[model samples]
Target: MKKIKEVAGNNTSDLVEMNRSAIVRILQQMDVCSRADIAKITGLTQASITKIVAVLIDMGIVTEVGFVKGEGNRRSIGLRLNAEKNLVIGVKFSRHVFSIGVFDIRGKVYTQQETEFGLDEFASDVVVEMKKQIHDLLKKYKNVVAIGFAVPGPYLRKEGRIALVTKMPSWQNVNFVEEFENEFDKPVFIEQDANAGALAEWWFGNHGRPINSLAYFLAGEGVGSGIVDHDRLILGNLGIASEIGHISIDVKGPACECGNKGCLELYCSANALLKKAEEILPELFEEEYENRWEACNRVFLAAKEGNEKALELTEEIAEYLGYGCVTLINAYDPEIIVIGDSISQGGDLLLPTINKIVKERVIPEISGKVQIKISKLTVDPTLYGAAAIATDKVLRKPSEYLVSK
Candidate 1:
């Protein structure tokens, strides 16, 4: 016990001078631990924990929650992060819309707002509109400390910018972090949306089962995947991995924005499915022109009500998605695959078929253990992801455990 506390104290002291990002790491690991418990767990001396906790308390970043009991009437005082003290901003950028949110270090989304910028506006008008949205939000809650972003395309982690193809022409290769930081005069961080969503699932959603390995499918304006194995996000050498949306299943099929033919998103994304519906029900567009979310939900409800056209469209979408799921299942051998974002509306209609295809395509042994389903955290995946990013960044660093105490 003394040795452990010493180690924890050393770790605490070692990372003491780090900014919020490194501090968040320590807090994330101290979830169920008291200040003393944290000191012991991190192998830091109690004195070090005292100083850190004192600083956090003075800053209103940490607070005493209550007393905790150990194995046999062992009493300890608990500490929790004060998420309401400092506001954090997160923006999830997609081709058609942006999900904006405000949170604190405890991974709570206190406020959420979204704005739609059509395909025609992603470059020229999007940044200006984004600034307007931020100003508008600041009018409501102005204490934003830092901003984190999740962008649809592959991005360079170091520079925090779009590095590769994006359906939106203007955003491609744009150094968003530098641009936003220079413009807003605040620190900025950016990551891939799917990766952020996967981190959200791992940190806030159900990942506690023996199966920590997961494949996260995000079917929004585009389809993408984020792979989590052994409780860590699998970011490859290029800082991008699990881009299942662009996987070409049909060599001769329709061309994709990623310079591929017959990519999964061509058939499975909300945009792709909406486009398919547009060809069949052109009149539906006359109404929900701007807010297609409602219209898309109606498509799912129509399928649920057994509308033949809706059913066919939904099934077509499911088949393509099932193929993508199977590919991910075979490749990653995940214990579970969570589907999130817009396509999750068809989750009930999608999961069974996805499992069926995986069963047919993958090894039966792996298929039996793998569970494929949609995230219950859908309506707020990006929101929660952004909040988690704040928790992770602001708190310092998240340890390997989901509940790290």
Candidate 2:
């Protein structure tokens, strides 16, 4: 196959940049390898690979990690990325919980913590708490270069504020980027949670396939989608384009805050699933449903264990979710759709039904053999994704972010 630069027709400077990105990309995928292996994979000459690797090593981006035995007692030194040299911080905020993590350029987390908010706390308090955590981390580590915040709603790129995070009325119109940058004394980036999750999958979960296009669906208390096409994220004018939750699946059903009727989230979100469970298993809810999240988990566990009622309810939720996926697939024509967040905890019991319903709803021409799968990073995609966005700046242009040792 031809190289990426060959098809893109890059000039000398662009070619150089592409070569650097390719080298870093190879190292990221391989995690550790000999210089010869990198040259073979990147299709760069051995001399060129040596030159680039030497520069990277000098800049503290790559390090020699011992060696592997070769023929006749020869040892080939394995080079690995030095992710801990410079740290990037990732922050994610939900209604009741906030998470902060420090990650290396390769998106490996070095340290992380989650804090839950009390019922009456406001956005200012959240910001203060986040700043305190970051300040403490910086004093300890002292190498953080950038911070990324993943907000749960539309984040305006130009204004640098979160548009509207439902249920957390105090967070509306809050500028996380500005607030974080001011407090932490570092560059900050804000992205929709779903969009950040999509980035995480593409940057870290490629699994050596390197898919150029895919859709990541975040299905928590609300539903949203993050789309990547041609290896680039599609953020609309306000930086929140794919609000799948607001997509009206039923015109005559209940009204939504976005002025739509029967939005996808109303019927298919994790909250919606739990609500369905509450209605179907009223006695169970009365006794065991202490938390909404716990209730959602129990419902899925029951479905996985072949409980007839739970299975039937899960199928219904999957059908509604499939409707949203069908729309996403038809509109974007992505190669695959990865579903994450609390609802995905249903695991195998949830995927097949979602796949079946999407296949049934969409025309073959539109579906075009799209595959729907569960997220590999099922725990916290947004947190990793936020870190990826910060680190990606360094990866794409190492000269800008890498400080000479």
Candidate 3:
């Protein structure tokens, strides 16, 4: 965890900041550790560690958990992050659903709920619903530090507006962050859903090991990826770096809403799965499910039960999804590519096919060591991603937001 410290030809203040960051990151990972252990792990001297811990404790960021017995039966007090001292709100907004979560500094979900929207729900209405959820969470808990929104399409971070959401065109031109901040009067972070999923995996999915680089491929309304290299998230011009779903796989195939011919989303998104299901067996959906989301779930369940048509659809999706992985493998060359979101409900049936394609089609030099798998998050990855965004802000500047109120 000492690697979390950034060294930049250290000035005295910079050096101190680096030590503080390293200590906090270590505490975050370990939950609780003795002062001797912190000093040993951070490579900071006893005096430096003691001074920094005192400052962090004064700032209300770290607290003494309890005493631990060491060599010679000596007892030392353990330090841990005051994770519950502040709260973060995470919202995942899609075409037809809004998922809200309240989380603490350690990525624990305090409470959460999901609400479905009507086909004609307006942007203002969506905002109102979000305000209600945030208000309820606040009513139950105090010291909310920030809020984060996980959106479906490319977001212009500079402009603070959604660039486009193909499934919900009305979301375009909406400055969601501004509106959220105005209502809540707190800092709000906006990010593409896939990128959020990526952050969640990097921060929480690694099981205490550091991930130098990885890509999270989120398949939902559309396919997208969040790319991380050297522990940094890569954002292209206008924060639209990994728009993989819009990448055209077929030059002469069906035209897409992005005005591309045969984009990857047309083949592998949750919507795409339902589209094919309706095309092949219209009656399956007409009589059973009330909406496309449920119908898509039905298809995945059927595939698991060895239904012929359902299995065929899974193979088709795996072929295209795996093809997308090839492109990601070649482009980012991540150590692991995690497939998540609603589309991943197909689980083993879909995962094997995608893995097979990446192994067979990717260049041996690049794919030789790449590991691909399904998401391991017990809670929704996107929700954790939202919390990660806020958690990152707090970690970077404890002085700014982690102080006693």
Candidate 4:
């Protein structure tokens, strides 16, 4: 399943970018904070925050709020994001849906949309629709400096060509950067959706985390994972890093699209769950998903409202999901594990149990600090990661964020 959650931080070099962005991200998160607070959160010196905030103010990306005067202290001026100053576009395409999002420099998605079409049809048709969307967005904002796509595979590092995208029909080895570049004549950044979602969580969702390694499980139409180590994305031996969902659990359970038996996708993905529901609960199949939104909502509502059958099915999926997470955690020793997918709509009702299973199954201390969480309902986290991809290419300087692919 592809995660459409867009958040900034798609690049390893991004946080390392001019350091000004680091300061801005810190300030943007807080309504208003003193320079000392910025320094405290970012480990940057007060002098650095002063210099960076100065440049940001000049760029009109931030503004100084009022000052706080305390009994033995001098008045300190607070700063906050100038959210109206600039805008970025986060565009994403998954198996069955399309999204066009407008975000601010703070990486907050202010205006957004989710569009559905045939997965086969979308792969071929997105270009035209995106072109029109781009045209319309540019006409209104005019200064949208960058746009990013949450792709399913790694792009060739230098040439920016997409490669090895198996789930996206006809998109394998396609040079999306070149296509989008020529069509829009703007910088089009692309990144793996799972990686993008993790970045969003690291940056905006779970900021200043005490832990290092994190596994972000994104479930939608297909399943995948993103890993970050020491604030950097782990690209694995061949940039095929975090293919968690494709891992064989049952081995002889069921044939997966990727040619493996009982792949996690067959059991955990929305498609798989819905397919099972059809056999177990034909009543639901009669109505159709109505759209992805309604489908997850219905299941989650049923799970929350104590529908026995729904709860049982949810537990079954959660058990597999938890077991798969165990494998990833054992391999990586991640500090945090974020679950983001259509199934996540079940929210706390789903994750607490998965957390329990993983902790019980994993070695004691190793699992202690690991946090299993559901992404915020409103933020399509991958979108912000796409925004971060745009920010990485355009705003960040060298040495800020680092990555292999």
> lDDT per prediction?
0.71, 0.79, 0.82, 0.70
* Deviation from truth (RMSD, Å), model 3: 4.7
Give me candidate 3's TM-score against the actual structure: 0.90
TM-score of each: 0.81, 0.88, 0.90, 0.84
Model 3, residue 208: C-alpha shift (Å)? 3.7
263 in model 1: Cα distance from truth in Å? 1.1
After superposition, candidate 4 runs with Cα above 4 Å error = 1-17, 40-45, 69-73, 120-122, 153-168, 206-211, 392-395, 398-405
Model 1 TM: 0.81
- Report the CA-based lDDT of candidate 4 relative to the real structure: 0.70
| lDDT digits (tens) for residues 1-405 of candidate 4 | 988888766564444454875665555556687888778878888787787777667766667879965337878886776655556788876766778888865676678877777646645466777778777887887557678788664444455655544456466545676677767745677778888777667656644545567788887766788887886787765555787777888888977656778878778877777777667766655675667657766776877788788888888888877987898788877877888867778777777678878888988887786777778736676667777666555445312221101
Q: Which candidate number has the best TM-score?
A: 3
Model 2 lDDT, residue 81, Cα: 73
Query: lDDT tens digits, residues 317-338, model 2?
Result: 8888788888888788888888
Once fitted onto the true fold, the runs of candidate 2 whose alpha carbons sit more than 4 angstroms away are: 1-15, 36-44, 66-77, 286-292, 365-368
User: Per-residue CA lDDT of candidate 3, range 23-45, in tens?
Assistant: 88788778888889888887788
Candidate 3 — which pairs collide?
none
